[model samples]
Target: MVPILDYLLQRQISPQWRGLLTALAEEFETQIGQGELRQLMYRVGCRFAAAAPLPPCSSTADLADALNACWQETEWGYVELSDEPEYLRIAHSCAPLLGFGAAALSWTPAFLEGVYQTWLSALGAEGLSVVQASEFDEHATIEFRLGRHPV
Candidate 1:
């Protein structure tokens, strides 16, 4: 079986994101007794970045590096995640370099929009509607709804 580390090392996550990945690995290891959790991981790539718009890394280390680069190597320090510093700190520390942040680097508004769409897909939002309203200086609201009745 491809161990979690095997997958991360394949991805090219940045040093910071690498640490976060290590943390997650430890967390999973601790929860190892719960086979379901491990199974969940097996189902979803250890990095949860299968949705990334990049090439398939040839090696695990490369995958981690690519993922890390995709996360931390954004347009300067401009990202469009939760504005809350506390939350942003947690997310920013490991969040993928996308949305406004990626746009910052590529200067392509769609890059930012792409990130937003990716976020929606990651959250399993099928048939969902997101209304975005920009707040001064990269702040925006994403109003959404579920496709079917809430479970």
Candidate 2:
């Protein structure tokens, strides 16, 4: 996945183009609302996962560890995981979204939420939800609520 993302980044397809695509999606999402967009993306991501498949991750902790490894391998960014009693707090640095500029950054949270939600579901993680809990310059924090089912 990292390699594919790298190829996209290197090709003329460029972050700007990707950002534009995301912007279009975001614009369309406005009418549907962010939550609806997130749910839609999550379902789409699940279908994508069905086709591509993720490596086995038995537990939510293991899933987080695997994701951290996957993110590091991709060269798109680094993710540091800190397990809390209630949830997993992930500090993300240099994710590809940074290349998308300020306006497009908003698109990432819901998209990543979808992707992560799909990944967790694929791993058979019941009662789990993922969200882009917060953000700062060049950094984002993803919160994974384990053992609590999505409502």
Candidate 3:
């Protein structure tokens, strides 16, 4: 998704066309209920993990390093992780979600949350849960807490 959007941006595509595409995507997603969308995202995440299981992250530092490496590989965003005693905090500069209209912005977070939830599940981090608390412009802030699983 980010790759395609970035490609369009790199080619200097018209903003109107981008907006139109974004709008259409948002509309399409709306037709799918939250439960179904999340199920699909979970499956996608599982598939991603099955494709290539990277080195296991056994500690917060390792998790941070792994996430940053994944972000670099994907070019989806810049990710920063803080391993606090109470929670794992993540701040992301999601480049693809930038410059789009507000309507398009709403769905990306939920999709991302689903992805994170499933990815973590696939990684066998059953005790950790992803909570998307805030989004401002292109930046998104999420928190992960131990012992609280996402249902």
* Local distance difference test values of all predictions, in order: 0.36, 0.58, 0.57
Give the backbone clash total of model 3. 0
lDDT of 1: 0.36
**lDDT (10s digit) by residue, model 1, range 23-77:** 6545654665444543453345323444555445554354345435665654222
What TM-score does structure 3 among the candidates reach?
0.63
TM-score (C-alpha) between model 1 and the true structure: 0.26
Best by lDDT: 2
Residue 147, model 2: Cα distance from true site in angstroms: 4.9
Alpha-carbon deviation at 113 in model 3, angstroms: 1.7
| RMSD after CA superposition, every candidate | 18.2, 6.0, 5.6
What lDDT tens digits, residue by residue, belong to model 2 across residues 1-151?
2555445544523555766776676575557765665566567656654555568976657766777776666564556666687776656555565344445555545555666667766777667777666653522434434346456
Superposed on all Cα atoms, model 3 deviates from the true structure by an RMSD in Å of 5.6
Write down the lDDT that model 2 would get.
Answer: 0.58
Deviation from native of the Cα of residue 128 in model 1, angstroms: 2.2
User: Which model, 1 or 3, shows the larger TM-score?
Assistant: 3
lDDT of 3 by residue, 70-112 (tens): 7668665656777666666666655354444445455445555
